[model samples]
Target: EELNMDLFSNCMDTVERCLRDAKMDKSSVHDIVLVGGSTRILKVQQLLKDLFNGKELCKSINPDEAVAYGAA
Candidate 1:
């Protein structure tokens, strides 16, 4: 599988815009609950942390199962 940096950048950019729109500072974001299959990839996690200034990211839940659990 190929990793698309452009797509990853766009995703990170979107997330940053959302956080900004919500008037939420990244410093206050303790947990980055990424509930998508793509987030299972390391690049996504690294990008998120980089964008959020190295804030701790939590990904303990099983990626495949967690989304289903949250959706229910």
Candidate 2:
């Protein structure tokens, strides 16, 4: 729970910052990408969507296991 809360808090803070800088609301957010394995957690993904107001954050790319695959 602690981890989830932390991730959610940080993600929301970052999103708020970006939105402020870009003069955008959640609707203006083009894409929300997760760059690490920790993103695989359901809590993380759900929190992301919730924070963005059900914007359906993009996960077309890998969130947890794409780096090593490309590092090769």
Candidate that scores best on lDDT: 1
Rate residue 57 of model 1 by lDDT: 72
Query: Candidate 2 clashing pairs?
Result: 37-64
After superposition, which runs of candidate 2 have C-alpha atoms over 4 Å from their true positions? 64-72
Report, for all candidates in order, the number of backbone clashes.
Answer: 0, 1
Write the residue-wise lDDT of candidate 2 on 1-72 in tens digits: 774587678876886898899898777667787778778778877878888778786687786655766577
Can you list the residue pairs that collide in candidate 1? none
70 Cα displacement, candidate 1 (Å) = 3.5
Local lDDT at 11 for model 1: 88
Model 1 misplacement above 4 A:
1-3
Q: How close is candidate 1 to the true structure, as a TM-score?
A: 0.78
